[model samples]
Target: MGTTTSGCCFPLRGSQAPTGPEVQLCENCKRLVLTEKEVIHMARTGMWEIEGYEMTDSSPDFPKLKESAENGCDFCLFLRNTLLSPEVDFDADEIPRIRKTYRDAGHQLLFHRAGYRMSIYDEGKLWLSFEIWIVHDATGDMELLPSLSLQDPPKPRVAPSQNALQSTTNLFLRQAIERCDAYHDKCKVGRDPAFLPTRLVDVRDENAVRLVEGFTIVGGDDASSSSAPKYAALSYCWGPRAHADQQLKTTDENIGQHLFEIPMKGMPAVLKDAIRATRELGIPFIWIDCLCIIQGNLQDWEKEAGSMHKVYGSAYITLCPTMSKSCLNGFLFRDPPSIVFPYHSLNGQPAGMYRIRFTRSWIWKMYLTVPHHPFAVDLISGSWVRRGWTFQEAALSSRMVLFGASATHFHCRTSRVTEGEDTETSVSLDDLGLFPLLPSTLSGDKLDEAWKHIVASYSQRNFTKHTDAIAALAGLAHRFHSLREKDEYCSGMWLSQLHEQLLWRRAMYEGISWGWFFNLLDPELPERVLLHAPSWSWIQRINIDYQYIRDSVLPTEPEDDGSDGHGDMSITPSPGLTDETLRLEWRLPGKSGDESSVVDRFMQFRGQELEITGFVARFPLANADKPLEVDELREADTNLFWKWTISGQYFCHTNWDFLSYTSWDRIDKGEFQHLRMLLLSSGRGKSSGEVSPGNAASSDGNISENGDVEEDDRTAFGLFLFPTIKESENGKFYRVGTWHSFCNGKGGFVRFLQYATVESLVLV
Candidate 1:
């Protein structure tokens, strides 16, 4: 049934388009005739606009049309015309009103000859395009259209059906189930048992499916009931199955095998010690890699790599076999037989009802071949041993642990002979004579058949040395060092030097210490001495003391020269003692009677204690034959000499002795009789063979047993005489006392005795 805008339904006449705001509606109820075009237009525009018609308030159609337009025309018309006009009839006259009302309500009527009717809006006009006509009984009265405005057609509501929702849910469930089943299938063939699924169930009911946890099948026949399981089961059978299957095959092939052969020796005692310690600790597992893995299979090695971290991390304690004598002995079977095995049986016979024979097989089975606890043997050999391929300790010690043997020590043999009857059986031994010899085994030989597969499986992981599995082993070594008592001693500064030497030897030169690593050099000598020369008389006190001490050891005859004689001589003495009859002089080379000569004379007195009671007498510049004149005598200044005298006194306390006094006269021009006589009396004259008093005693006061003094023990003294002549005077006479002394008391004592005199005669 078609709805009309004016609450009426009417048959259109002719092909005329509606004008002047005419709208058709059902006569008995509110409805509107909307053409496809009108509906399309309204939908497209999102708004409805109709031209030209207004209903009068007095008109019967006014209320319905107003109501239809005001309150959702589609719903209002559906209710008023279709629901309220069930038995109502409409006349031809009423049809026009109904159409006009619909038109006024902004709907156009469409008519078809086949009784199809609809409303249409074309261009700027409302036109009758088509109508849906229901066939009527011919006998029934012809009904007129109702004066009701058609409301807008109700909007369509689109919602999904239950089947669709169910279908969607089924799709997701199927995918999840497929994934789960495929997983289980892979796990069944995979080597790792933990990957297998423990529980599986199908949940097809929608509500039950939603409640399903993880991957599940829903609304499917039981797996056993079906000729073929769909989805996951199918996937397991075909899709990408070969990859998982091949992986499984590889895992099975490589599992429990080892690829590297490790040869070691000198390990029996260490192994035994480790075993005993393990037993004592009551540990259940030990992870000695050599025994744990098959040496001929890289697959096993790779698998071990995954669990190595845990294997090492969980270990209770790791024992280093080479750390001590006891450990080494245990590893090498060096211990006494009594300690290793307390009881023995002989020939399977009962001794006093007890057998006393040893069964080698039982021994091997009980101790040698027995596996150690997995977590108790994490200790690994150091880099030095590993790099050198010296696995003796590592191999045997590893056998005591559950970790079979370290890959580095697998297949290793010791020098120790296997127990059996010997036809003089001989076993090759390593350098230490502690390990059994091993034949060469290489990984390259097995690469194609085994190693490649293992490598492919673990290629995704990085195994850089510094950060990989060995890092843990290094840390373990450090911990072991910390626990050992030797750590402190080994870590001490001196010991570190040894460690450095070892490190350099092993790391730098592959275990050799040689001179080629260091640089060296050669050897050479030294230089000479310099001296300052001056007249001996002018020598300072220190010079005098040095000369005195040095010259006393060497006696030599004085040189004869006029410059050292009394003629043209000068006398200078103490300033306060005016004794003109006395003259002071010095006898030495290179001298003349002048101011310079007098100064030179005083210089000779350096370091000597002199008692002067004489006058200053200046002699002629060059008059060897002239009479010497004594001026009004006054004591010459003696401060210079006094300083030397005091020093000499101090020296006497230090064991110096004087042994000689000498005089020279210008008139005699040689050794004068008076000076010679005085010199002899004062002990100034010593023959070349004579020994000085200072030499008679040693510093320690021990007298020499021999009467003659040793050269090294000699000391000496000297007195000098000079004759003065004055050119201005006719005749004069002067006497000067010169003395010599020695040290002979506790230290050395000095005693002075005069030894010189000279007479001047006038020659004018």
Candidate 2:
């Protein structure tokens, strides 16, 4: 074109322009046609430029990217989206696609945002630049780019050389050292800035001979230098031995591991099974006081006492060994909330069964050791409730954080003997007690008060007197029972089982006395006789008879063979003319035959009767002379009456003898009847023959020559007889009768009977 020297420059029409730079299209099109790699290089090198794009000092047209700057521009918008957004939130449909397209085309979208300017500069070529501003609608959503511009790049600033930067850094370090010295003089020895430095020097001097260390110091003029003081030291300053003494104390292997072993017997089978299950599950430790702590050492005990919570908390699992089926209904069997949800399949399918929620901690409070003193600080008296576990769940789920004892025997023993002593310790956590805390709950003091009331209501003696006490006890029992039924934390079955166990324990420890029936018998009787007696009558009649003979008739002095002074004849009855008549004779030591004679004199003594039904005996009077009266026994038409007789002056018949004889009759037996004959007397009473009824014998001729009558045997009859008649002395006897004949069914009747002596009654 130049060679042609034509004055006109012809524009190329459909045909492409020449590839040479000098022959390229106008500046605008040339800027747009540049390769993406060239454009990126221009932007990064700050070399892209355009003619007539220079700014004057007054214009200051460079864009500000900071949003806080007053003259913020589109460049700021690009900066904010590309570098400042804390989280990325690009336009979903286009951003990822555009990024991928650019990446595939070997071109990068350096930065792009709505209403923002993007630019590129070429460094290899004459400083050339291109810029664009994105346009957006009123809604603030982004739109396509609408305009572009080209600009010339500015010159670079002058800076110091590398060597100059290093010298300035050294000078900064020297100034920092001078400032550090001045600061050290103003502060105390330990608080001085020099303190750490001195310590570091000491360490370096000790270890520098053996160690090579490199370090960098920052100071003036270096790009990275700061005005702050610099620090330097040998590597040994930070070595392991520098603060070896400041390390934590080494733990002794036995510090918390010293355990006391206590052997236990008579553990419930259920508990044993639970223990076995726990062991099988891989639980390694248990802190049961009866099994883990020594019984006698106070120091050891205190140590255990202090660490009770830690022991329980750190346990992999606790075993609740309640054997009572009722315990299944209590709080110990509750289920945790985590297990309540249904299982979900990996494909988001719903599973049929609920998944079990397993937790690392299972607190068995009712069975765990009570926290004492400071140990209680972290323990709540009722931990389960506090942990958001309900009593019902506890009652249902056997595997729980806490467990309760089924039987009162174990409960009381564990609570009172082992844990009771620890109650004095302060508690701060909820897991310490038998139950956990729940919302709208009473404080510990209030709960204690409530517990007292609950306990009193259930007490046996209290209920026996006050009918309200029974109701109160029942109410409490039912309340707890209902909680067991309703709570998800434990199973109702376990709670119910616990109740049954407690009842049984109460019966064994505080209910009826089987010992009284057996222990008050004669030793001479066959063991079988005493052991086999199912009711109190057998004990009173057979065993008590011999017991009375030994206690009242036999002399205290030991004979030649170590037998009682009284001869054996005292125990054996002689044959009489009739089968119903029996006679016994014996001599008291130091007493004459006349004084011990049976036919000499007669004595009448007043006594009272007590009744025995089944294995239970009731004393109706405060003393023997008082009349026997039981409101429940007033309606019987006839009652069994056991009579007594004491004869000899020195041989006194105690009232207990009246209980030994087996006799009974209609209450209408003509005022008095000959109950028995007496043989001997010791001091205050007389011997008698034919100890007959005060009135004449009945016309039916029921009386025998020996003075006993074979009366109608329809009424209940049992005997406790004493033959030595004594006058003006009180005697003990037993009578089974009712005050009113018509109301016979008012009181229950005896269903069984057996007999044994007092000496045979002791518990082995």
Candidate 3:
């Protein structure tokens, strides 16, 4: 057998095959690519259903056919793949059964048209599907086929070698960078240059020792020193605790030595791969968080970590090791295309120099290519997506080359290109659900929509330390802040949308226990709250789902447009909604000019809490607000809300394990009369009608004392709270859970609030 020059496949050495139109082809294989333009034309016209060719059980030319199929014939490759699944590996022993089923069964290779793709079937069962296209293989050029919905041709088939893969990837990187820099306006580096990070790994000289050099590019009349140096940022997982020892980091002890030399031999495989990729792209520097940030040094870590937005957003390109879970694994190497089909011109001429691979399937084109938000579909899955810190890193970057499990994908503001494929101009980075390049001119509604999507997705991710949750998201928050600098960031929630942001509920997932809700805790203890995050903020909980309640009626500071008024987003007030009982104020702790530690400085302004002048309704709460002592309450009050009326009210407790009857009995006996529900905001009922008497009725239609009926047309949302007992916690209260009542004319929360006294209180 003689193999191709690329050594990818073996062909019959000197077989005198028929030439031109007289070439030997079986009935089934001949129809597969009968007329190159004919297949392409049929695909364009949506007419794939045809009487397919059948495979005979036995043939006089069986020996010749087997030999032809075994060799590098395109028709034979299709036959082999039809007998089995492509992109899947099978053992030699399993091949007998696979071929036996097809040989005797007289399987037929059929073509069926799907949405913008073609599906192949054998014996009336789906064999495999492919996204086929016609292109000039010699020049890597493609003809525009709008009817077929073709974006680009698949990546050219190459020899299964690491060096080949690397070389091809480097070519792709160069082309992507060149095109993005020249034509993509959204992807270009702005005229006002962003300075490099405080520290960067110098990867300029291949022979020289790599070092972590401090960089500060102050732009001026001089172009070289003024312009930010081209650099790459690496995004990867650090692996589990077992691999902690293998992680190379810059620390206080090694800072001096790292400044002189960062030993390439001692570095992890992922880091080394990133450095190699950066050098291949002709970038002079690269940023790896563990190597650039001084680990274990709180001040240095915080300062660098806080500015992650600038580090990634300003980088020339981010190298994403999406397939690798740990620092020990490298992403540069890849398995070449296993299956290759001979290329033919649209005019039916042999294009022997190049080959094609069925890169995408009908299923992939259906689900992944939909014009919807990326988060709605599972586009990319790996350790990178699961990490909390990487969310901001990917979201902030303008361009990234993701080394995915199946193929290498390049993403920028304007395009998404996969290895061996043409640049897909219709799709953008946001379409992949990796990162959304939100325009700086975004309106309030667009900003809110993007923010909710981000928070919903990011909240589901994992973090090593729960305290790092707010910090991990700070970079993204900082970017949003820059768009609207007048808005104050309150830990996690924005002051401009504080009321609506606080309405997030705990999103539950099957099989995963999303932390239990706690009833009460000692306010004097600092651990009662999750570090600086207040109870009202979603940052205090993971996996929260926000449903914006209604428009704000409370007083808000006018946006300081600062002369240019560049960030003005038109605000439309709700017609009838208002916060009648609550006047909210954010109280920031006094900050001294002298701050000793980095963490102290970071948390100084983040520790602020809400001081509300609102109505604190004294009521005996239900099981949802707090885990009531149910066993004791069941006997004391048969008319308890849980027993008599099952109202369609929603409550999300902050923290608690189990509900007990004791708390209700205690309230009945006046032992726990300190519980209060602070009314925050209210709105007119979604539908206006007199409260129906049926709303107060129990399952048996019997009215109970606790189910008080009232004629009302309003709904209210608030917090369930208990006053602090410790002297150090005096005049303060802790939020046990969230509360909301849909105003039915009977037993309405708005009517209940009418009797409550409004007072000033601080919530911890």
Candidate 4:
């Protein structure tokens, strides 16, 4: 190869293609940009590797190019943004040496016809490897490059054609639907909505939401007589300004006018984009919450809210503006600009010939990994996946086109596809969030896996109105209800697994302080939310975790109605318990009177408390490891971060300080034994030879302190109750927290049961 006067032995190509201003390239940096002929010739082969050159201390002043990077050199900028930068933990000082490149403290660059791979290594371990591949420029391949410095933000790298609709985006949508219809047998089953939303926006019109029955397709027949016309649904955040009267919303006064035509120019940007996308996809109607449901009309809102499951689930497809922070932010915003290397010719002459857009290291890092959850990568900077309402919308929909930042992501029950050259990375319905895609025939352990996964994920999300916590999940709960039609939804928990669901604990994370009694660290606890639901329910608080207890936890005892045993059933009676000793009765409001609607029935259920029959045992908080005197405990108040004790197996978790709940001077002996354990169910314990908890004390003289007893496999799960003036027919107690006892084969389980007094209590 001939070399340029600047020692730039590189090939360059010239074309009329628009690109950023040319950047000065060093002699060694010219190889980063390849000629069109070289790219094509190399593309014919499988792979290409180049080695031998190494820049070291003996090399020229490579650091001198930092000034060029700061001034705006693309080659230097790419180096500064990637390998040569110290942004990430592993920092590369220079390019890999010829011999040391394959070993420690160096770097390696792998090339292919399309693009290249850059790997950074330290101490003989691969620290980071990211790929930059060639992507065909399309009408929708519009993305904005990052600002070179704090002061200079670059313009859009690839602008869309003026009159061209996003053909690539439309193609992905059409292909996704076609593939689902043709190949996805699973996706074809039971996903069609039994009925459409009460109303839908006629996308072909600028603005209008009509009754689904009377809606007319744009270029097709009237939908009333035929199977409901397919419609798209818009899933975007309403943002804090959503409730402002300025937002375009369908109301009682304007309902008639809205049915005729909606003012599209005045609508949120997201709504406009959704309508545009739907119209381009040949869908005549789309359902938008603010436009379809009457705002400010309580009855209409509740009625429509109850049917949201069908609205999204039945839609032909859901248009998710994944990166949109709010309705105001349109989905068509430019993607993060990728690094582009202007192609060079064999003569070392450079021009805007081939503006090859290659991905940045950060973008590759974000999308390359299998996300821990649905939209994990999107959630890193976007608000769509973090909102509570959108959670179910994404899960319940039959198909979705997530208009992501860099590329469009398509999802159906059978497959997840991302637009671009990288096809290996895809989402799966088997992953968390797509709950409706799960097997409907799932039972027992499978049910636990599904429900627990949902709860854990949903708990971490933010809800605009705390009241919508359970309401938002009603649709998903209904789907779960279909698996076992006999089971009832109790606020958040199911009546079938009420006992196990009651065992939810406040999920601990790094930000929160969690330590033993002596190391009491107070977390910034939120003001206790007051809801009609019982404290035992997970709905009482967010950021909760649940333990999947088996049906074997049901005690094997006779029924109060004189039944012999729980026979030929999934839930068997444990060896030592009876119906009276361990029973649970759900008191729902609709059971007493006829409820006209599902919304009303669910509202009544959410407001009702749980009635449980179990054995009550008391444990003195005074026996805790860092026991506090009356004055010290009372002064600690709600801020007291100390934990209480149950048995020697482990330190028990309490929702609050039990010591502060009692009247210090009013107690008979000032013992502060206000901590009460109510055993709801029991099962065989996990076999172990571990020592008892430090605070463990024998409640009975007959119980042995030594590990001499037979293998007593009894594990009792229950709630720790605190006395409350709030009374009910059975008993008056509020749930402080939950507990499950472990058998240490040292008579600890027997002692726990011996201390129990059988009683019926209503938890509030």
Top candidate when judged by TM-score against the true structure: 4
Model 2 over residues 582-675: C-alpha lDDT tens digits? 2211112243456312111111001111211112222222222312211111222111122211120011112322221122232323222312
Across 542-646, the per-residue lDDT of candidate 3 in tens digits comes to 655443242212213333322222111222222233455557787667677655343342333444678888787765544224432112112221211232122
What TM-score number comes out for model 4?
0.63
Regions of candidate 1 where Cα sits further than 4 Å from its true position: 1-273, 323-329, 332-764
Give me candidate 2's TM-score against the actual structure.
0.16
TM-score of 3: 0.61
Ranking by lDDT: 3, 4, 1, 2
Model 1 gets an lDDT of 0.23
- Which predicted model would earn the best lDDT? 3
Stretches of candidate 4 off by over 4 Å are 1-165, 192-194, 205-226, 242-246, 337-375, 421-430, 433-445, 509-530, 547-581, 589-593, 627-672, 683-711, 726-730, 744-751
Of the two candidates 2 and 4, the one with more favorable TM-score, higher being better, is 4
TM-score of each: 0.14, 0.16, 0.61, 0.63
Model 2 clashes, total count: 136
Poorest lDDT segment (10 consecutive residues) of candidate 4: 147-156
Root-mean-square deviation of Cα positions for candidate 3 versus the true structure, in angstroms: 13.6
Candidate 3: stretches off by over 4 Å: 1-165, 188-194, 216-225, 335-380, 420-445, 509-532, 548-581, 594-607, 619-675, 682-715, 725-731, 743-756
